[model samples]
Target: MNIKVFIYDDNLSRRDSLKALLELSPELEFAGEAINCSAAVQDMETCFPDVVLMDINMPVVDGIEGLKTIKQNFPHIKVLMQTVFDDSDKIFECIKNGASGYILKKDPPQRILQAIQEVYEGGAVMNPSIALKVLEYFKPQEQKSPLSEREQQVLQLLAQGLSYKMVADKLFLSFHTVNSHAKRIYEKLHVSSLGEAIAYYYKNLHQ
Candidate 1:
């Protein structure tokens, strides 16, 4: 099925470009577009889009605030942030506010489309630099993970780019046991993916 996409951006040119791109991509459908997200909930409800491409800077209500509102009202709809700014603080804020993905505005059109598809398929997407920043941003926080020691060990291995099988072998555990530990770690960390769990662990590792 084609992914229904809505756009929220203050720049007329950007909006037009996005609309044109959607028109050309067979996998994507243009649901709607808005200049800003002052009435994000209303606009989103009207469109009922599967994904929203949101710009960070806007008049009155910025993308971060708009993202919060949209998530609050329509938690099922995925929101991907598109912005020229790559500030760590803003990126973290958007994630905490429930944004599904973050892509730089300077990214190629194909990358943006891939991000939308990734988010729609229940995967989180971010620029490689953004991912590193996310990991670095949490390096100084106190550890607050509720995972057991075994789970922590598994997660640590996972964070070091180990595959599940590799982690299991290193820890002298069965594959099922390793998978179980990873699942528990995700639950305790309130994250959905290994990347997010690693980010959370780094943030609270000092504790």
Candidate 2:
């Protein structure tokens, strides 16, 4: 199957170059291009591409914010961050905001095509350096995630500044059961106090 893709980047030269590179693949088709996040959003509504190649440093709403909007509104569209910088902060922020891949601006055309196909197959792609950073950052998150889904829901509600009674009412469960869920959530998250739990919740709200 041919994968349709949209390109978003501020630089005209880079955007066109990337588009040219993507066209070389028989399995990939260029859907459209946008100069900024706002334009990208409009293009997405019209074209509905399977994947988006986004640049991290754009005017108005940067790639990170743009990515958040895309993931929230169009969950099926995979986003790949393409930037010149290989810094860990940008990589982590992009992944946290639901980017499916990260490729350096200098990466070969074949590599970018491969990254697109990888994400299409439900696998995340990252530069080796960025991959290492991702593994390091997510290790603690995985450790905190061993809780059941109900427990997680209860913890999320409580962390949103909701009282136990409110959470129980929202979940339609007894206060005692809600309390048990909260307790288990705290234990699994390795947090000793409600404040700590809330802190963790705020920290990992996306995951």
TM-scores across all candidates?
A: 0.67, 0.65
Residue-level lDDT of model 1, residues 75-120, one tens digit each, is: 9999999899889989989999999999999999999999999999
Model 2 lDDT tens row, 1-207: 789989889999998887888778888999988877875567789988999999999988789888988998899999989999988888878887899999998998888989999998888899887788777876764444576788778888887789999999999999999988888877787889999888877777546
lDDT of each: 0.90, 0.86
RMSD of each: 14.7, 14.4
Which segments of candidate 1 are over 4 A away from where they belong? 140-207
Cα deviation in Å at residue 11, candidate 1? 0.5
Model 2 ranges off by over 4 Å: 138-207
Best prediction by lDDT: 1
TM-score of 2: 0.65
